[model samples]
Target: MQDQFDLDVFGNYLFIFCGGSRNKYNALHWDGDGFILLYKRLKSGVIQVIQWPRSREDLRMVSQQELRWLLEGLSIEQPKAIKKAKTGYFH
Candidate 1:
């Protein structure tokens, strides 16, 4: 995974999903000193298929709200949602 995505560049949290059944997910996070790995499996439902980038060259960054939408089985692209304003611009 590191070969494809730069773990260090992703700040702290990196979410990975399995291929076959797509029923499992792993979250890797850096907690200052060490790394923490969290795994989760659904007993009943499967997570929605996300439109992930096809190649390593097609990298895209997601916002916190987009991540929340993804975790909630919703598409990350929300047209109706208000865009987050840029910080440090107002007095």
Candidate 2:
């Protein structure tokens, strides 16, 4: 994962979904000392399809609510929800 993603820093959570069926997921995190891997599998019901970004240019940060939606088998894009404020917009 570090090599594929070109990760040079620690303290970031990387979420990985299995292809086909999509019933399992792996969460990889760097805990400053070593890597920790967490895996989860649904007993029933497959995880909803997510429109994942295909390229580096499409990558963006997601909020806690968005992560929750994803785990609950929902899209992260909440069209009706208030959007997060951009950095340095007030200044």
Give the candidate number with the greatest lDDT.
2
Instruction: For candidate 2, write residues 1-91 as lDDT tens digits.
Output: 4455454547466655555767777676778898788777877776665655555565667788887776766667777989878887574
Q: Against the correct fold, how does model 2 do in TM-score?
A: 0.66
CA displacement after TM-score superposition, residue 5 of candidate 2 (Å): 3.3
Candidate 1 lDDT for residue 27: 68
Tell me the TM-score of each prediction against the true structure: 0.61, 0.66
- lDDT string for model 1 (1-91, tens) is 5667555634665655545676666767777877778777766566665555555676667788877776665567777999888888687
Model 1, residue 9: what's the lDDT? 34
lDDT of each: 0.66, 0.67
Off by over 4 Å in 2: 9-11, 79-91
